[model samples]
Target: MPALNAEKAIAQEKAIIINTESLNVRNGPGLSFSVAKQVHKGDEFQVVSSENDWYEIKLNSSKTGWVANWLVTLKAGSSAKKGTVTEDGLRVRDGAGTNYSVVAALNNGEEVSITEEQGNWYKISAGSIAGWVHKDYIAGDAPETEDSETVSNVQPDNWTGISTDNSLNVRNSPGLHGSIIGKLNKGDKVSVTGSVSGWFRIEFGGIEGWVSSQYIEKPSSASKPPANQVSYGKVIINSLNIRENANLNGKVVGSVKQGEVYEILEEKNNWYKLSLKGGKTGWAAGWYMEKTVAEKPQKQQSTRKAEEVQILYNGTNLRSSAFTNSAIVARASSGETFPIKKKTGEWYEVSLKNGQTGFVASWIVSVSGSSDSAPVNKPKSGGLKGKTILIDPGHGGRDSGTIGYRGTFEKDLTLSTSQILYDLLKKAGADVILTRNDDSYSSLNTRVALAHYHDSDAFISIHYDSISDSSVKGYTAYYYHQYQKELSQTVLGSLVKSLSSRNRGLKQGDYFVIRENKQPAVLLELGYLSNPSEEALTRTHSFQDMAARSIYNGLDEYFSE
Candidate 1:
């Protein structure tokens, strides 16, 4: 929470790169240093000294690399600039000049700096920047007053020695390349227990780990609070490169969203094995998710006019009527602004600047004078015009019901196929309900609840079959409740006829989604995941369309009866 001013002199400082590009090193102003290795944009570095356009920096520990001055900026605020506590907090600006952009504002007395001055703005080279703060807002810049007490007692002995410049590696084991976990940034404090071949055995984020001594600085007696401890109670989505194993080149499963909550069940090295609230468990790197709430600007005047609403997506058209078939009068691009004149159902009558009036789906456009926005159409389809079917893709996140042979996750395949099917149904004038759109992990309860909540006429779960035998192939329909038997049979027959693979036939299953679903529900295993040939074919456009057409035919047949 300390203000990071670029100019505030501190015994130590760390620069965490936010830009997702590398900082290329070039020999120039300070030619006295030998440089090696490219500094990836997000990599953190320790500031040893700065003169002119070149900075003498240490990256990932042992190596002394000269970083280009502009690519990597520093933060400046510390306790000394304002007697350890000033009445006003510092601001973070984009650049060291007055005209720089304001990246973030700070609370009063927060630790940050007033490193230098360019015109009216004082540069606080900290985590971020603040631009053009009034002189009155500036606080104490005088050196440490006599009243400044030595809080070194709060500092752990030799803990501060672990700087970001060390070859510090968070690993699954104590030795080299043992699943390199998290990268240690400059000024990161960790309690050292032992050392091996320039590797420091340190306790990191409540887990015992090893960091290369080359990347860490010598321990300082100065005490600062250990970087905020990870709170285990709240859930966090993994935001960094999360792999199956804790290795650098490990295959990425997927990234966890920032600010997502997860329950921490265990910790090893720098990996926090977490249990998601949705009953899914996964390992995540400790360095990625920061646990801090930033205060956002709440009082800025409305930059947009009350009559203008921005378009959410491109190809948005103004139709004659609220219906999708009302006939397009005009098309709007993404971010186009328009004024709403009236509302009919979920559609809005928007009057364009050229005096043309037509209806737009309100969900796709935001109200100009208000902060509210809505989706153009709610996923819930009310009209059962052609065929009424709810396609629920099961087990989002960790509950991926089954895994395919070629490493195609069930969650992904189901959602992909469901989307194609939904589009097909829509184009055919069939009413459809897709439980979810994106790769969000959802629970079976939620999936079933959605179908019943929408009063869907029928519910079908989409999935790819997986088995130990790579030869097992073809589509299969599963029905639990007897009411869904007729629908399942019809869909199954069409799938077997439409798809070229072996027919698995319709069978009864106690699948949780179908058994508990309030509406008539059936689960479909469209293809075998273990069969490589089938897997490849299942992923094709032709196969997806065939599956959709088959399902539609089956629905039509069932409904006709």
Candidate 2:
């Protein structure tokens, strides 16, 4: 099983070749899976890619299967020593140094058969996927396989662990912001089904939930928090109070907003003691902070010059391949800059600081704003500070809104979009209140009432439009009062620029939230769920993130003005 300290990965996947006789190729990705075929150590196959410690080789035009990269080796080259990959997301450069281009990436515990060595680079190869990895990150060797029977039986067992701390929270999802669903007491036995981002999924009391791997004890994963080892935590909520104590009534020492980070000094009773400036410390609620879990040594900012092109907003998708439908390599955060390597019709190939390349949409890069291509790092808290933004997800419960061309519920989409918007706004330093954070329903009156009661600076009613004509696909903003016209136009302007959607234009419409509310308000029909293509696009994580970011950017502009 993978360790908790490792960076966010499904699992590690790197290896080198061997010259052993008659090696078994697995039908599946792991050793425990059935063998598909046998090949000599030097037998070559068309190498496509690697994932989760397995090499994908094309058997024929239509057929493909996984093989252990450990069993395959280069026919001519002989290895000096077998090594282990020490870091997650370690660059496999074309040469040994940072100047070299990244040919591939290695994850923690991956096999590293060093064929040759020069300075800091080692010639590591497993068939077609061959490159030089840094020597400092190559550990001694992967565990030697003594026998076939023993190797075939190697698989991770489901974790049976005892809770080491009192009241270990089990969340609905992996991260700290995932709502708390239950708790486990000290010494209680629990079984782990999975792990992601340093959190373990376990089944308890008829609920499958996740808990921090830190407070749980499994013989293999059992370890205590290191002394003087600090973790960087990004604020997950808008404007969290940094207090003098761990309790609610503690004196407010300082304030931090979304996109802000601090070094954690200690953790107690669901609160984090933060290392503030001038060597002082302050306590903040842990539930509003997301801890970084990077096992690799942190890469420093590039001393090289900046690129001309930069992402205008956060949640921008970075594709791994040239093809438009390729796998998402990563998500670029706002204000995080990258030098443009080149540009095609629709995509911008950007060189990341990690020495790897990724493609982003040109439309996103071209959307110049007040902070367009800002600095490469995430920006400090901005216009969202002290702003009370009410987000009303349009429909819920029995009110499913319009049915999409793909049968997607409009209520579900609204809720999903609003939830993401809430996070972004909170992180940006807004006191964001969601009318319905879950599947529950809220009457229009209640939603409007909530905004008025909070004395909200701005109110946004999020919905998706539908039409009988499937050809019609676009986003629109509506305002019921003259006061909301500017808000509607500003937000819709941002949506049109940042997203690849048609602008249906802002219209004066009698929407209850906008008409009845005294605050500056707008109702956004983000997209036409009835359009098959647009419906499919709206459901993606990338699109949802982009939509939320666009709206947040619009609000930021409104508040700044």
Top candidate when judged by TM-score against the true structure: 1
Candidate 1 CA-lDDT value: 0.57
Measured with C-alpha atoms, the lDDT of residue 88 in candidate 2 is 71
Where does candidate 2 clash, by residue pair? 13-53, 17-72, 17-73, 18-72, 238-426, 258-427, 337-376
The root-mean-square deviation over C-alpha atoms between each candidate and the true structure, in angstroms, is 22.2, 24.0
Give the Cα lDDT of each candidate. Answer: 0.57, 0.66
Question: lDDT by residue for model 2 over 222-291, one digit each (tens)?
Answer: 5655431335565645488998887778889899765355666665545678876678889887656655
RMSD of model 1 against the true structure? 22.2
Best by lDDT: 2
Candidate no. 2 TM-score = 0.34
Give candidate 1 misplaced runs (Cα > 4 Å).
1-387, 397-403
TM-score of each predicted structure versus truth: 0.36, 0.34
lDDT, candidate 1, 466-548, per-residue tens: 65567778888888777778778878888877778888787877555675554667788888767878876776657877887
